[model samples]
Target chain A: MAINRLFRWITFSYLLFFSLASVASDELEELVEDLEYEIEDLIEQIDERNKRFKINGFLSAGASYSDSTVPLESTDLLDEVNFSPEAVLGLQLEFKLNDKSKVVTQLVGRGKTDFDIVAEWGYFAYKVTPALTFRAGRLRIPLFLLSDYLEVGYAYPWVRPSAEVYDLAELFSSQDGMDILYNFSVGSVDTQLQLGGGTLARTSPSYGGLTFKATDMITMAALANYKSWTLNANVATVDFVADITGTLLGDADNTFTSNGAGEIKFDHLDILYYSVGAAFDNGVWMFQAEAIDTAYENRPGPQIFPIQRAHYISIARRFNRVTPYFLFAQNRTVSASDRREADAILAQAGVSPFDLARVFTQLLDHTQSSWALGINYSLSPKAKLKFEWKLIGSTKGTVGDFEDFAAFTSILGGQDALDGTNVYNLVFDVVF
Target chain B: MINKINSLAITALLIASPTLVLADLVVVVHPDNSVSSITDADISRIFLKKTDSFPDKNKATPIDQKEGNPLRDAFYSKVTKKDAAQLNSYWSRLIFTGKGTPPKVVRNDKKVKSLISKNADHIGYIDSASVDDTVKVVFTLK
Candidate 1:
């Protein structure tokens, strides 16, 4: 009787335990289903949010070689075949909060800067209306037609923009401020106007890493489009200051210091700049031209600044997937009046004019003309291979864009020694 | 033999049906959209993000077929007058400059039509043959 009772008890306990286990298993499955649904919901939310974000990028990898030892143009290619001078990669991110506003950031890394990434553009844009927009933060100064997209080589027909106009504005590419853009259509023509102002502080690598500041800046830019033609004009002004030291000027530091100028500084200099550009394209043939002039005023020293002008004309003919183009560009700087004023100041200081002639020629007075012949072959819709052979010459002044200006001058002993230079560059540009 | 001939004819017709369908594109909007018809310039402006509203002051959201779609190519070429490379470059300029963004791209005409049919603000282009009562035809490309 005892054995039978124990057997019944064990059987009942086993049945109860099995029922409880089944119930717990059912709950576990339900919990898993609920968790999975929640995860799916979370993923769906993330996917929907991701749709409002975008990533776009552009890259240019190329090598440049110059015939002379001097690093020529803003490319800064020396005699030795080099790859870094012209290579660049950039990435842009945009996040749209809604249809009316977005945030954009562009980071660029250049071979010239040792692949150090820089935030070239970071701005918040708000569309007040369909025709008007307001942007604030770091923005590209609209000083030229391509200033907004200067680093994007795939957008243009040339491997690089014309150095004549770009080199002068390169240092002032972006500013921290706000701009208003108004776009409208008049009949069949489309017009766009941009006005902005900001301050800029940048370090000049060419000047031994000395820093310069520009304040009270203002810019007005306009563009008009009709059929195959586009015309744009831009004007800007700023007050500039540079803290200069003898050591930073390289070879000129000692010469100026020994001449009783302890430390050279340019303060409260007012500068005015303007540019006009036109482009025409009719599928097969394309033409582009731009002219820029910069004038400096309110100088505290006789050697403060000079008037500079630059212009370029380019024509391209597309043959199927390949395009062959030709460009002619000129850059000139005049400082004769400044030189006379410096001479008068030196005369009063018991210093000879001849002692500073080299200094003036090296810094203030120069002329450059470049003729480039190039071909662009579209590898794909987003990429191209470009080859450019440019001839750079000095018309009436020294070759001003070279890197080793003082050394080149000392070796040649005169401004006229550099007649010309031949530079060849092969680049691949892509946009995504 | 008659049955064989019938089957062969059906096969040939089936094989040739895709080519026979014309892909001429038509711009579309929701059935309840306020705008009845749109001009080519207005279509281009909407697709290119130049204007966010229609001529009637209604909010417009432009949708595009994914890149490399023939219908998209035809629509942009005919209306915006830009080829694939030119259009891409143009958008790249605007996007990189923080000026504008391209229209949201869907997979194909059917997707575009479905999306537009669901929202009055949505605008898209589709093949003429894909037009149905759910979406209104705003502009037809020549």
Candidate 2:
């Protein structure tokens, strides 16, 4: 920690000193002349010493609103609508090692949500020439154009993410392995083809007072993009500690076998997303959309988790200063066998978590739709302001939200999922 | 007093109306060049670093006014449909990667008019009202 701090200070002071020197001698003609030369020299040096490395990112700060007469409440007192203190921060570094190889890293830390390091990806790439390039490293699992920038937090259209598409994958879809990318051109249309596979590691857990080590994970994915159309598909099988009834074991790995408790299960998950993203200046009318489906095996205790299906569509119209958008998203994930099996396990476990099973059963019966109304104002190229109001009412009113709309509700038994209760947001974001 | 105020308002309108009219920059090539009219999409393709040459058989060396010029803003808004910051981000992605750089910016109208005059294959934009015999107007912002 001390060494890292010392290094940061040194780099910061060097940057600061040069900036001051540039500013302090601005008016003198001779000094200005020398400064220009110095600047040119320094830029050349940066080019020579640095291997095409570049830094970029964004930051956002905002609040939210609720339709209910009173503002909704949440745990952190951070994301409350009428007023609150929360900051959204993100940063990324791209190191261009050469024409064919590069490294990219990004970090997202938000104040409203617990601040932590999340979504780190790095890979080695080889250009098998301009038309054919191959890369083998952990990639952001190319599901969407926005997927690579998903966690950069400041790179999107919402204060928080759309949630519909952002949360499609339970854990990030990155894997440890190799991929091949081919960029080609036919007449006027640009085409890119990518095919590869990799083994995925379990994300190291460091939050929510409980830790989970994503265990024994492997994945394979294929995707292609021709101009505005994108096709993506991937599947993975992972080992997990099944939800046991009675004990509150801190670590699942050490206790899974010896405790005479829960069973170790293999979860095979398959996901497919096909999207057509197009941009046209139909006189400033822009649109983007993506459709997706997900399937889980053993969702109901390693045997019968049922097939959950969902799709989301979004459209946006831009008129100079204001961009308003409409979105419709849905999920149908109710399985009687899965719910009953979960209940039976919880009822027998004799643990405090049993109470959650009843709520899950109710949620299974309802939750027809999740949609949002949003407005984004491009006050300037450097700054943007966005307001989003989501309507997440359950088909069976008191079902999905744990009987709470105005106060904090534990929507997911996992404890990590956002309290999908009713909430709204006002976000001010910028990228420099 | 009302009469005086009206007179003053009329004078002000006369003074400001020309600037308010928003002169579109007509991006053009020298007259002998083969490419005639270009679509906003083609223009966007060139400016966004998606292509290195014009639709015709010409090597396109792009020229622009200073970074924050209103005419520049108007031109990009018409072609790319992305605001300035968005374009800046797009350019950065290309520039820092050595894939491309934004067109070299000229300081004023005279520089633009002269540069386009010198190269038949070059691409550039200047105030539409500022067009002359030296440059042929091709794509207009509006």
Candidate 3:
């Protein structure tokens, strides 16, 4: 009796909403679940086929060759120039609601390093009228063209996207949310207007407190893909909640220090994320590149500046399924040592002469640059292979630090040149 | 052995029977529809939610066969260059993520025929052999 009541309530609610909002005259969005078998039957008759769950993915393994003479702090590091293979396998179960919508769940296992149960994505949607559609649930942020299809390996011509643009932490961002996307034509270009915002809450040691409520984190993004030229822009702000135990206890001392006033000086960091890029893809050869940057701003002046700036350029050629591509990227960050470029700012704050001298010394030895190169080969619609090499260099910055640390600590100096390392990787990817 | 023979006989008869042939899926429109010819790409666009409208002025809505329907698979693959499993995963990424969905589906040939005949702005595909005088056939499965 309860089951019947629940079903009845759902039917009533569906009918109530359908009657008020439906534009297709039939108010048939609710028929999605009811028409599944018929869809399968028609498809079977026309194409002569049936349905079954499927599984597919790829494997990756790599190693690296680094210039050990350089310092890891300033440049990218590599212990050795060698080979290590990394592999991942993904399986998907798909349910078709009709020709337009489907329910799919994909599980991917990344070898070694990282493992977790991720929803990847899930939701329900439909278009009742040409001008309006409905979608609700956890979804991908369509800030970029690839945002909708980021996980499907065959969608792009790269083994792994360039870290410069792809690793911006803000682009692949997703959480529980809803959106309404409307399409209209501008002159000869077809455009889509996607307006959406959602709340993403996650708990980790990186943030203090109990990983509690941190809502109102807003994200707004848009994209324009006309012909071969595609451009995207997006902005989002996320607040970090207190994970005091993790931060304070995990610090050098497990106690909070105050200036004798019983008032705590805690760090609350908020990120201001923005990015824009454009690419051209018109069959044959394709040329693409993107520049992405993030500005980290803190509440107080004591906050650190990341000084991270990166971008990459790539070219690809597709001769049927055997498309080969090449990419190059360089990224760097300037650490805040209170003496790098704001010496006057710190000096004005009334710092002792001794600390000011120390700041100058710290500035002489900061990070320089990190970079990478890659090659990707698309073997087929379902599979591909990729090879990459990276070289990160730092001289004036790390050499001084290594020399100073060598002078202070005999152990690191007693060993060898306390500097850099290398890493190499290969990957196999696919879709089912 | 006798049972196997009987099953084969039934299967064979089912495939050859005219009664089981069903009806042609007409590419339809309102009787006063203005567009002339629609390329396969255009039809795919309409059904895949890539593009909407008759290129004249009428607002358009796509009608689909049910999910996992063999006919739906054939049509999608013919245009989208994707297999059945791939399409399933594609829609999952969209629908579950609340991005987009396929078209609303009609049950069988009879239901599709009725829906298309009643709505001029609606377009759908059915078995070519099932075409009748009551509906207009805009395109055929080549």
Clashing pairs in 2: A64-A81, A245-A349, A300-A305
DockQ of each: 0.25, 0.12, 0.12
Off by over 4 Å in 2: A1-53, A65-86, A98-101, A112-114, A117-119, A123-128, A131-137, A152-155, A203-264, A267-283, A297-306, A341-368, A395-421, B1-38, B50-66, B85-142
Best by TM-score: 1
Write the residue-wise lDDT of candidate 1 on A126-188 in tens digits. Answer: 999878899999999998889989989898989899887788877788899999999887655
Write out fnat for all predictions, comma-separated: 0.41, 0.13, 0.04
Put down candidate 2 lDDT per residue, A139-256, tens digits, no spaces: 6665554555554333445455445454545464566666676655455554555665655556322112222333444444444433334445544444443332232222331232
- What is the DockQ score of candidate 3, to 2 decimals? 0.12
Error of 3 at A211 (Å): 5.7
Whole-model lDDT, candidate 2? 0.54
lDDT of 1 at A69: 64
Q: By TM-score, how accurate is candidate 2?
A: 0.64
Stretches of model 1 off by over 4 angstroms after superposition: A1-47, A247-265, A300-304, A340-357, A404-417, B1-22, B29-42, B53-60, B119-122, B136-139
What 10-residue stretch in candidate 1 chain A is worst by lDDT? Answer: A255-264
Q: Residue A201 of model 3: what lDDT?
A: 65
List lDDT for all candidates, in order.
0.77, 0.54, 0.51
Docking class of 1: acceptable
